[model samples]
Target: MTMMSLSWSLVSIANKKQQQIRRFKITIHRLFGFAFLCSISFFLFSPKIPRSPNYHQFADMRNLLGVPNTLNVITNFPFLVVGVLGLILALEGGFFTISSQAEISTWILFYAGILGVAFGSVYYHMKPDNNRVLWDTLPMMVAYSSLFSSLVVERIGQRIGLGCMCALLFAAFTCIVYERIYDDIRLCLMFQLILPLAIAAVAYMYPSNYTHSTYWFSSIGIYLLAKLEAVSDKKLYRANNYVISGHSLEHVCLALIPFLLSVMLICRERKFKRLGDLKDQL
Candidate 1:
């Protein structure tokens, strides 16, 4: 009887520990959500950020084989490659280890956005001007929105993920429209930065359901590198002796993100499940 009572005491302690851990996780998640809302509120209420007058100007303005901004135009082909391949594998279902329609659908939207990037970016590079810039920015913003939504679906539940996705989609659309009408890119730029930061935050704070989460981390690193390349386009072009520009390299770096995620989908397995544990606790 004494041995049995001691065992019971240990079991009680473990259960209480699990309960405390669960509550702590919930509190942390809520705090992160609140902080995000505050940051977004600041962006919405802040002043307008206008697109630069020289936004169309890109480094490496070479016209090779009758192609204007040849490197820039050619670089977009990587988006088409990964976008199409990712869409195909995602649609086939069996090709990836995905277990639910929700995630599959999110991936479909993400790949679709990537494909749009290919066409929109190509068109914009062919004749970059204020008039054509909308096509370029819109598709990329859509891709970013889809990316953030995909990570939400992975870390959070399906219902909340889907809801956030619709909200984010609407946010992306509104920002683009605002940019076009008011000639302001502030909201759009903020969302771009916010989404990636949120991605890293979620990855760090939330427990992942699937394996290969390191891919997401590495992808974000790739994104930062791409952004740096984009900002230093002229310096990179001069450094490379006019062979290739940083903007072109940026496209390549950005394209690697989707490819990395796609590889994750193909390789990852469902690791742990909370449903059974919760049911047992109840």
Candidate 2:
């Protein structure tokens, strides 16, 4: 908590480590650019991955109380609750240690996307077909876009993060259009995998201005676990004696990401100045 104190740890890293950090800073942009180009090129040139023909089928299709896919449909109710509460807190302001309006705006978009997901997912589960897939998919994509953008705002800065948010939003729409025109959800799937990894990597590389960085890791871990649950839907359903489907549990698990993030916001404080900000001050 000492600002610019002559602490041994602050000025005492070996010369080789400093050299490595300097080299990393110098090549960071080019590294990201190359990775971006390679990812796009690979996806564009690769064989198209068509939406599985049986994608609409769910392990739990129980018509409970006149609702089809009842568990999956109802599980999204938590998103509604969490989304509304998070949105309100983000807008109400003064609760989080957010630095700028741009950061707040990104969070607002994040929660708004979650709210959209709640409704869209319910509608999609009602029929579970390509015809209704966009409603479910696009909202979650938007949520992922903004969630990552908000993290960027925290670690990098507001201006660049806002730009990234806009770009990601455009990409989200592109994923939908590509799916419609080419019948390939590969880009969308790739994005879902990429964003969490991006968040984890970025959070590790960038100096945060706040405490509780572990919360970011926790959220990412939960996201991966949700993906695992989704993939094991039938096994989980049978394992639990048909009480809950993995896909439904996935929804519940994903809901915890935002909840944990909200808790992080409330609990974290400005524990250190970003080194970049310090450099600028100098």
Candidate 3:
């Protein structure tokens, strides 16, 4: 073939390949969107989950230094420390350069929520009642929703991310309200389950803009460990000779998540200058 014809053939092949990649990315986006919708539908249709009568009981009841559930309650102090430190860092512009004001605000909220968890959880463990449980779980929902928003902002558009953040916060509060009025926790539980899945899916489907995306995965791993610890609370307490419970360690693991995320923000540099770069390239 002539040089001109060969060049044209090569260009055509490249164009086809580009189109295929676009189609694949679009397909993945649609799949994630479908999964999100299904999660919402399930939350709307599922029966209300009643609070267990035994939910207030914890394996570690040892009073230490005049505090009940001392380890579980005190281990949460790291959350407050991390949260306040994160907020200060954000306020002082300690994160990677190019983070916008809105992004900083989201970080602040996430940290503040962590701080609230510290106080609220301490109060809940003091009494172990449903009313106090609201205080504990409400702040957690805030932290979870803000983290979701932060990830969305990093991987998607800022406007879209902010909108999703607002929606998620509203959903989170609604769960609390629904539980208070109806004494059911289905929506709250669903929110907890769905948000992590959404975060994971977004991380998987979208290209990372920062160098330390692996930190997100690490945070998720830590979160899963916390959940496992929480579920195996009694077993872990017994195994440890009643010195500390899995629930307490769960708090410690959870506290690490925000700290790791802050480290990511502080240490990682951007791979892209704009959202368009993510779409047009990776």
Candidate 4:
């Protein structure tokens, strides 16, 4: 073929490829936009959902070896241990490395939230009231929102991720505060349910720079198991002759999740160079 014809053919192929890439990105953006709008609509239209009257009654109430709610209360200690460990790792820069200061701040917030969960959960299990439940759930929301934001930052872009993290945290706190004032939990429930699904979708859809992405899936699995155990708390207590309960196991599983995530961060490495360095590397 003539050189001019060959050159024209190559340019046409490159343009077509670029168009395809642009279309793909636009499609992804549209999908996310639709999902976001649906979520906001649900929150705005949902009716008030009050706390269940029997929500505070947990299984494993035995004063085992003179400890009240021994299994339930004791299992919660893992959260504190893991939380402290996570904080130490974050402070020591033992987790994954990031070039951005914003990313570092995000990690600190996430670890701090984990630490707060330790105290808040213990307090809630000690007395198990709506008032105390607030403490337990508030910190949990913080951790959830932070983790979601971190995933966003990693999968998406830095500025967009930071913005999302801030927006999500604000939404979470608003739900908690609104619940406290109005005795409604619909928004909180929506946040809890939607965030995980969104995170999972992001994990599946995006390319990760870090290894050990499976740890995110594992954490999600453990979280689902914990929820199942919590739901079956009374039945498990009865089946086990009151020695232990599903709720106790749930606590253990929940604690392990953050620990697993921390290990993932510590073990993971970037698979690619920074965006600006890509041209140099090429």
Provide C-alpha RMSD values for all models, in order: 5.4, 4.8, 6.1, 5.5
Q: 141, model 4: CA deviation in Å?
A: 0.5
**Clashing pairs counted in every model:** 0, 0, 0, 0
lDDT of 3 by residue, 168-256 (tens): 88989998999999999877887888788778867776667679789888988999999999999999999988878989989999999
How do the residues 1-282 of candidate 4 rate in per-residue lDDT, one tens digit apiece?
455665575577557645644654675588669867877787688766789868888867777687666777778788888888777777776455655666666777888888888889888887788888989898888888888878767766577668878888899889899999999887788788878877787777666767889999999899999999999999988998877899998888888888898888877877655445544544
Candidate 2 wrong stretches, greater than 4 Å: 1-37, 40-45, 273-282
- Per residue, candidate 1 scores C-alpha lDDT tens digits across 1-282 of 655765676687557645645654685478568857876787778876677868888888899999999999999999999999999998999998787788888888999999999999999999998778878887787787777777767776566667768988898899888888998887777778777887787778676768888998999899999999999999999998988999999999999999999999999988753445544754
> What's the C-alpha lDDT at position 42 in model 4?
72
Cα distance off (Å), candidate 4, residue 146: 0.4
**Candidate 1: residue 271 Cα off by (Å):** 0.7
Give the top-scoring candidate (lDDT).
Answer: 2
* Regions more than 4 Å wrong, model 4: 1-47, 274-282
- Model 4's alpha-carbon lDDT is 0.79
Instruction: Tell me how candidate 2 scores on lDDT.
Output: 0.85
lDDT leaderboard ranking:
2, 1, 3, 4
lDDT of each: 0.83, 0.85, 0.81, 0.79
- The deviation in Å at residue 207 for candidate 3 is 1.1
